[model samples]
Target: MNNKLFSVIFSLAVAIALVGPLFAAGGGTALQHANVNVRDTAAVQRGAKLFVNYCLSCHSASYMRYNRLAEDLGLDEELVMDNLVFADVKIGETMDIAMRPADAEAWLGKVPPDLSLISRSRGADWLYTYMLTFYQDESGGWNNLALPNVSMPHVFWQLQGIQKPVYATHDGIEVVDHLTLGKPGLQSPEEYEGTVRDLVTFLDYLGEPAKVKRKNVGVWVLLFLALFALIAYALKAEYWRDVH
Candidate 1:
C-alpha cells in the first residue's frame, strides 16, 4: 500500500509539473511568476516612467488611460502629460503602442508585449526581477527568457549598466548568483533598481486598473455578505425549530 501510494503521488506530481506551466502560460490576471501588491503608490510611479522611456517604443498598455494613471499615482495632469505621456497621446486617450506586429517584426522581430494586464498575466515580481536580471547571453545572443533571440537591443543598458551571469553548481543544480552590473550608466545601480521596481509597480496597476476600487469596496461587500448570512441562518433556525 505504501509503495502504491508513493507511486501514485510521484506520477501525479510529475504530470502536474510537466503540464502546469504550459496550461498556465499566458492566462491574464497574473504576471509570470511575480508577487505584487498593487497598493504601493511609489513603485507604480517609477514603473510608469520606465514604461514611457524604454518600453513605449514597442509595447503599449492599451487598456489604460493617462488620466487614470495620474489620478491613481497622485500626479498632476500637467506632469503626466509633460513627462510620461508619449507620441502626442492626449491626456484622455488610452495608452496604445503604435507598433503593429508587422512593424515590430520588421524591426524588433516580435511585437512588443502589451503590459496592460501583464501584472495579472505574468505577476509584478516576475516583471520586477526580469527587468533587473538581464545579462549578456552568448547562447541566445542575449540573455532573456521573456524574449529569446530578441532583435530588440538592451534598452535599459545605459540606465542599468550591464550584468554578466555568474554560475554556481549545488547538488547538480545550476544557479545564478549576484549578477554584477559592470561600468556605470545614467543611473547608478541603486537608482536603476528603483527604476525597475517602479516599472513593475506600474505594470501591476495596469494589470488591475481598478485595484483601488476593488480593495475599497471589498470591505463593504464582505460586511453585506456576512449580514445576509446571519439573517439567513436565523430564519433557518426559526423554521427548523418548529419543524423539529
Candidate 2:
C-alpha cells in the first residue's frame, strides 16, 4: 500500500510538471525585476503621465477614470482635462480611446486590449521586461526578447533608441542570445530603465488601487497582533503561575 501510494503521488507530480509549461503565457527569456513600489506616489505619478502620453494612444484603461488621476496622483483637474484627455471624453468619464474596434483591427490586425488590469494579468516583471526588450528585425519590423514575433512596434523607440539581436549557434541551432544597442536615445540606459520601472509601478497600482492602503493597514494589523499576543502570553503565564 505504501509503495502504491508513493508511485501515485510521484506520477501526479510528474504530470503537473509536464503540463505546467503548456499553460504558461509567453514563453521567452527570463524576466527582469520591476521593483515596483505602489506607495511611491511621485514614481506612480510620473508613470501615469508616461502611460497617458504613449500607451493611451493605442490602449485604453477603460476601468479607470480621468478624475481619479487627479485625486490619486495629486494632479489638478484642469491639468488632467487639458493634457491627458486626448479623445472626445469628459473629465469624469472613463479612460477610453476614440478609435473604434473595427478601425483598430483594420490597422493593426487586432484591437489593442484595455490596460486597466494588465499589470495583474502579465505581472509587473514581465511587463517591465517586455517594454524594454524590443529589437530591430531583418524585415524592418521589431521583435521583443520577452515575446518573440510580437506584432506591436516599439512605440518608445525614440526614447529607448534602437537595439539589434546578437545571434549565436548553440547545439547546431542559431538563436538570439542577447541584444546590443545600436543608437543612443534621448535618455541613457539607466534613465530609461528608471522610466520603465516607474511605468510598471503605475500599472501595478492601476491593477489594484487599494494595494498601498492595504499594505499600510497590514503593517498596523501585524503590530496590533504582536501586542495582543504578548498580552495574552503574559496573562497565561500569570494564570499558570498560580496553578503551580
Candidate 3:
C-alpha cells in the first residue's frame, strides 16, 4: 500500500511538473475577442478588397490564388481581374508581390512574413487587436498594444486615424495604460472596428478555405453514423428476440 501511494504521488508530481509551464505561458495578456464570422460573404468580400488594396503591396498571400478568390468570394472573374489584380500575375497564379527580399529588408528593416497562414498561426482575436492597437510613441514610431515594438508600420493609419498612448506613472516609471484617439481619420472609430473585423474574417477564410465544406461534411457524417447505429441496434434486437 505504501509503495502504491508513493508511485501515485510520483506520477502526480511528474504530471504537475509537465503541466505547470503551459499554464504559466498562457497567463500573459488577455486577448480581445475578434468575433469574426467567415460565413458572412459580404464582410469577407470587403475584407478581400481591403487586403488587395492595403496589405498586398508589402505582404504576399503565397498560398492563395486570384481565381480562388472568385470561387470563394462570389466575385466575377472580370471584376477580380479589373479591380484586384495589380501585377502581371495570371488569374490562376498564386498571390505574390514584386518586392524582392533584400529590397523589403532595406525598406522596412525586415522582410514582412507571408500572411497566408497568419490567421491560423495567430488567433483571429490577436490579429484583430493588433490591427487596431497602433499608437504614436515617444520615438515617433508606432507601437502596438497586442505586440509591443512591432516592426510593421500602421499602413491603415489613414482609415483608422492617429492614436496616442495614455500613460500613468507607477513608482516613478510611466506606463501606457490605454490609447486616446487624437486625429479623426476617414473612418469613425466604429466604422474602422467593423472594417478590421471584416479583414480578420477574410484572413480566417484564407487560412482554411475548405472550413465551411469540412463542417458541412462533418455534420452529414455524424448523421449517417447515428442512423447506421440505430439500424444496427434494431437488427440486433430482431435477431436476438428468439434467444432472449
**lDDT (10s digit) by residue, model 3, range 19-127:** 8754542313456788998778899899998999999999999999999989887889989999889888899999999999899999988899999999887879888
Worst 10 residues of 3 by lDDT: 21-30
Q: Rank the candidates by TM-score, best first.
A: 2, 3, 1
Candidate 2: 10-residue stretch with minimal lDDT: 19-28
Full-model lDDT for every candidate: 0.74, 0.88, 0.88
- Candidate 3 clashing pairs, residues 3+ apart or interchain: none
> lDDT of candidate 3 vs native?
0.88
Clashes of 3: 0
TM, every model: 0.69, 0.87, 0.82
Model 1 per-residue lDDT tens digits across residues 1-244: 6999999999999999998875554322133344455677777777788788888878887888899889988899999999998587799998887767897878766667777887777566557656766677646355653433446677788888777767779789875544676666789877876767777777777888788678878989999999999999999999999999
The TM-score leader among the candidates is: 2
The true-versus-predicted C-alpha distance at residue 86 of model 1, in Å, is 3.1
On a 0 to 100 scale, what is the lDDT of residue 200 in model 3? Answer: 95
Tell how far residue 81 is off in model 1, in angstroms: 2.2
Q: Candidate 2, which segments miss by more than 4 Å at Cα? A: 1-25, 74-76, 237-244
Report how far off residue 145 is in candidate 2 (Å): 1.2
What are the runs in model 3 whose C-alpha is more than 4 Å off? Answer: 1-29, 170-172, 226-244
